[model samples]
Target: MRVVIVEDNAVLAEGLNLLLASSGFEVAARTADAPSFLAAVAEHRPDVTVVDVRLPPTFSDEGVQAALAARAAVPGLPVLVFSQYVEQVYARDLLADGLGGVGYLLKDRVARVEEFLDAVRRVAAGGTAIDPEVVAQLLVRRTSPLARLTPREREVLELMAQGLDNGDIAARLVVTERAVHKHIGNIFLKLDLAPTDSGHRRVRAVLTYLDA
Candidate 1:
């Protein structure tokens, strides 16, 4: 897949470029700052764009704004955020339009090459791969509907928000698939989420609402 990277840190940008190259992905472009990043994406339209949460000028929410604008210019362009902090509000804003092909992941997760690639691939395939930490932060708000979930239910929902299926979450938690299903059912009830086309999409909508 062709990839575009938007990270201000020179060292991290080089490292990410090398990582993507070694993984057999074409590095279409590498840039920092909002204008350049958006321009690169508009010019190359890479299969996926890996962006950091902060960039030049402010180093606060420039990356987030760029990502949003890039997507606005090219709807469903498959953007994956690589950030150290979990800004739940930004996550919600990114998904405000309910557009798929998006991912919000922690920068620390890059150490796990396979997992990072999985998230990238998932986003490219029009799936959500939200960070569990992002979900945790969203759940912390008192107004979060997830506040009604039990501890186990919350754990299951957290994994689900990461785009994991019942089987995957079951294996991760070392529990039976049936137990995972049961927890999912309870989760739907607690969150007042109605069933959708399939498992992951429904859970993704719930997670989106939590972030919203």
Candidate 2:
């Protein structure tokens, strides 16, 4: 499989390149910034991309935004986020599409080379490989009933709370109206807002989100 490495750290990027190359994977590109990473993705069309949470310029969430942009350009493009810290907002944004070809791992917690390789392969195969530590932290942070909803569903609910209709939400999210309807249905179900209830399900769902 082909791979793209997007890390500003030169030594770490080289090490990752060497490791993947030795494991029979082709290192198609090694980029240090979001713009270069997107260019590499467009040019190389690698099977998977390994990204860090921080990058050049601000060194904040550029990597996450780049990964999202690359996936937007090439839907379902697999990505494995290797970062030093667990940026909750970044993780949520990466997962907001509800696509399975994603992962987030902490740099210091990766115990072995095998584990890292396995995460790359799993994400490349359109599966999730989030680090256990990442998952635990996310779970601990979500202390409300909203935790039952997926990231995409939460986004839909938030839009609903803003009084946006299905069409408006779809337009804002760049998704089809049918998809937005499905997400609303899922939100109602997950929030336990039964169809038989006297109050409007959408209103109830929004209330739940606001309360959360």
Candidate 3:
């Protein structure tokens, strides 16, 4: 498998190149920014492309845009997205076209070398390898109900989706735990999640967050 990497962090890029090469994949190109990434992809037309979620100039969403552009330029180009944080919305954009060769894994997962390599291979083969955390963040019930939420509630949900507990969420949001509790209750009611034990309901809410 031939792979091209587009990441601003030189050390990480070298590490990925070494790992992939050692695992029998060809390291076609290693680039640090968007233009070079696009150029490399077009020139090499590698079997797979690895990209960080942020890149040069703005350093916000450039990598995702580059990946999307490459996929557009070369249909079905397998892409494995790496990000420092969960961006369910961005991941949705990547999958919106419905051409399945996509994978999204957290940057930290690179430490789990074998699984990361497996994700790369799976994506290169046109299979999906969404991080379990990412899926748990996306697939249960919130798509439509999400729109009904006020901005504050939506903020709470975002924090919740990241696996934060109510107390932790309150600290991050600068609100009291009681307020967080009320907001969550309202969120559950708005989403129409039936009343249940606290633990089960939290799990269900996370599931709803996934639905979007």
Better of 1 and 3 by TM-score: 3
In order, candidate lDDTs are: 0.79, 0.87, 0.83
Question: Which residue window of length 10 is worst by lDDT in model 2?
Answer: 190-199
* Distance from true location, Cα of 32 in model 1, Å: 1.2
Q: What is the C-alpha lDDT profile of model 3 across 36-149, one tens digit per residue?
A: 999999999999999997688756577888999999899999999977744445567896677758999987755778889999999999998887876665564234647667
lDDT per residue (tens digit) for residues 111-176 in model 1: 688899899889888888888777666667437766666888888877877778889999999999
- Order of candidates by TM-score, top first? 2, 3, 1
TM-score (C-alpha) between model 3 and the true structure: 0.65
- Candidate 1 regions off by >4 Å? 109-111, 141-212
Question: Please, what is the TM-score per model?
Answer: 0.64, 0.66, 0.65
> Which segments of model 2 are wrong by more than 4 Å?
143-212
lDDT of 3 at 145: 49
* Candidate 2 global CA lDDT score: 0.87
